[model samples]
Target: MAEYRLKTPLSNEDVEKLKSGDIVYLSGTMYTARDAAHKRLVDLILNGEELPFELEGAVIYYVGPTPPKPGEPIGSAGPTTSYRMDPYAPILIEHGLKGMIGKGKRNQDVKDACVKYKAVYFGATGGAAALIAKAIKKAEVIAYPELGPEAVRRIEVEDFPVVVVNDTFGNDLYDEGRKLWEKK
Candidate 1:
């Protein structure tokens, strides 16, 4: 229940202050990637090739936005199911990714990675794509344009809303809520 406004690229201190269930309004830059983009990112890391963007302190949103309407930077940019990227998340986290925005729960490896890496996972509201799109001030395809909507895009956001689903301390909001409900 605490509310915080944070800017990226997030610092370790910034993530350490957060706890699961805290509401966060994030501003500054974030990148977009789905499963395909994530795989490519991991491949680049494994190959010791240059990545399209800097990974240190970076936040990646699990989204593939639809084509924008006139005068808009993006469209219907809701978070996709996060688990799809679970396979590659730990590697990215180990490499310096600091945050993630998506829906649903992440696997144990991802949660553990957060604790080990001082990273955090934020849950964006699903079915609120259009509303979320409003927060994106600018977007540009930075890599893998052939992936189309799944392409990696660099985006700037202003007060983009999210909730801390998993924190650097290995706390999980969904599990906490489940326990609370069971107690009730």
Candidate 2:
């Protein structure tokens, strides 16, 4: 495994260098979206409508953060289970989504999309929401405000931690880990 620090609007080269189980600390801007926002995004794509944000080389985090307390950019920003977004992930990837940050396994179609499109799936530490929030320097809802926490937000992060769960080569960290345990 390798460790890399990457800036957003990731290129094919950026994702190509990664391997499953590699460590990554991402910096720069990324967007937040859960199931609801994902549906809307895919719908816009299918309908040939303009999206709220540019999709090229973008990273999406599957999170619906808690409201900030007294003064903070965001609060308790943990990853949601990835499967919920599987239905729409491939379409997004095909449209130039470069990375995803979430928890748990992804469906085969999503995995295939990553391999075909030079995208990657990243896993954030699920229980470390408070700790993760510290890396988010700024957050603003860019769309779907009525969804509250589910609103799409553009966030700026610095050295935000993640693990490469599925890489462009189609390697899956979760599967590799399971195989290692089976050998034990």
Candidate 3:
């Protein structure tokens, strides 16, 4: 495993260099989207309509944060369960999405998409919302404000930590780590 400090709008070259179990500290821009936001984005694609945000090389973080306190950009912004996004992920990946940050296992189709598209999935530590929110320096709703916390928000992060759970090479850290710890 290696360590990388990457900026958002990650390139295929940047993703290809990562492997499962690697540590990554991401900076720059990333979008926050939960299931509702993902479905909306996918709907736009299917309709041949314009999307609110550019897909190419974009990183989507699966989160729905609480309302912020005074002087903060966000509140308790941790990753949501990733499985909810699996149905829409392949479609987005096909459209040039480069990275996803979330928790839990993704389905086979999602993994296959990652390999085919040269993308990667990073896992954020669960139950660490307060700690994670510290990295988010700025946030602005870019679409679907009606969804409230589930709205699509463009965010700026600094040194946002994550672990490579699924890499472009098809390695899955959860599976690999489980196998290592399993006893006969």
Candidate 4:
């Protein structure tokens, strides 16, 4: 019901204040890690190895960006389907990840993690990659460069647009909107 401008490394209090369907323009640092990167990150955690980046209060965006053209920070930075990252999400959430940005629905376990951990799931417009790219001011591959597009990148964003799809309070915008718009 409200719009908020958020910065990365959000606190539990910051996440708890968001609700499903709220519009958010996020700034500051966020990580990009699709399926492959997520698996690797989890493996690092399970093996007691130091992660390439800090996880506490971090926001991870599920994306496998296109190779940038010369002189661009990123290209067609679209959100990947979030479900593909579901298997690894809860593990990351348990370790202090505060938010995720992606597209499509996440499983119940992922939602449960959001509620239990006081985190949130944000949805970026699936087909708006080109527009999204403009918000990314800087990008640098932090690990798994061999994964190419799936490589984990640390990005700085300015007013990166997204919507609250799942909130810490256990509300799901996809489900709530469906219930409201379905033919009676």
Candidate 5:
């Protein structure tokens, strides 16, 4: 495929076109959630309740942000490790969650869910909070505001750099990339 770059307001089809390792400049309203929020969401799922937002192909950023300063949309924001959310991932996938942005290795079930559901897992650079927050143009807490940093917020971002660490084809860049470099 040709080198493709996407802007905000991308559709599900637009998200679907993304491949592993494709550089992206994301700009749009992306909802933020993390491990605890995910647990609550999954609980609601078991209770046969509706989610706060339509997740079908919607991008989820795995982050719990620091309190934003006055006049700032959000505080420093960045991807947390994906392993913490492992329990609830498949459920999100089954519900049409097309992608998850986080860091570190995801569980096998998460990888399997990607294959079964055509989802992708992107890894934003770890510890790049200041730069990551810059991509967010706006922020609003959508759920669990009392959770403080773990609050679910709707954030709009632009040109957020990420690499596809895990692709739907069952490839893991963290492992594969390391194997290439760690050769004895």
Candidate 6:
């Protein structure tokens, strides 16, 4: 149940120190980006357009959710499947992106980027929309409002729980952890 508050972008060393099942309380700043957003972001890089935000040590959360209720800032936001973002992740990692928040498996290049750039890929529980949404305290769109669900947002989260999926050293706890349990 260790807690971490991210005031600045996290370093690779900082990411690796985290292990599976560790509770993370991320704050300061986080950018929300889903499948469409990822595509646009990578395209920006390819075109040499400046990014809307700094990526160094930044954690990108993959989510596309229902519209928020009138008074709420967000609605039913949960970790979406991570595999869809894999193709563009390597480029982001190269550009100083340090952390990613999502659920499920990632490609080998993404893992390789983790090793090469000292980044980490984190997984929040899937199908726990209501519970996970509680971690988010505030939300505001920072880019691509026209994209609807694909819009990027700046969100503030408290006591956000996440597990380290891929470590900078190339260890995948998802596979290893499950295999260990399966052997029992």
For 57-113, candidate 3 gives per-residue lDDT tens digits of 999999999999999899899999999999999999999999999999999999999
Total backbone clashes of candidate 4, pairs 3 or more residues apart or in separate chains: 0
Residues 1-184 of candidate 1: C-alpha lDDT, one tens digit per residue: 8999999999899999999999999999999999999999999999999999999999999999999999989989999999999999999999999999999999999999999989999999998999999999999999999999999999999999999999998999999999988953
Measured against the true structure, the TM-scores of the candidates, in listed sequence, are 0.97, 0.98, 0.99, 0.98, 0.92, 0.91
**Cα lDDT for residue 167, candidate 3:** 97
Number of colliding residue pairs in model 5: 1
* lDDT of candidate 6 at residue 97, scale 0 to 100: 95
Which residue runs of candidate 4 sit more than 4 Å off their true CA positions? none
Clashes of 6: 0
RMSD of each: 1.1, 0.9, 0.6, 0.7, 1.9, 1.9
Worst 10 residues of 3 by lDDT: 68-77
lDDT of 5 by residue, 1-184 (tens): 2245565444556656766667666667678889889999899888999888778767789998888899988888878988999889999888888778899999899998987787778889888998899989899888998888988888888888888766678878878778878958
Candidate 5 lDDT score relative to the true structure: 0.81
Per-residue lDDT of 25 in model 2: 99
Off by over 4 Å in 2: none
lDDT of 6 by residue, 134-183 (tens): 88888899999999988999888777778777877788877887887895
TM-score of candidate 5 versus the correct structure, residues matched by position: 0.92
Model 4 lowest lDDT segment of ten = 32-41
Residue 90, candidate 3: alpha-carbon lDDT: 99
Give lDDT tens digits, candidate 4, residues 56-156: 99999999888999999998998989999999999999999999999999999999999998899999999899999999999999999999999999999
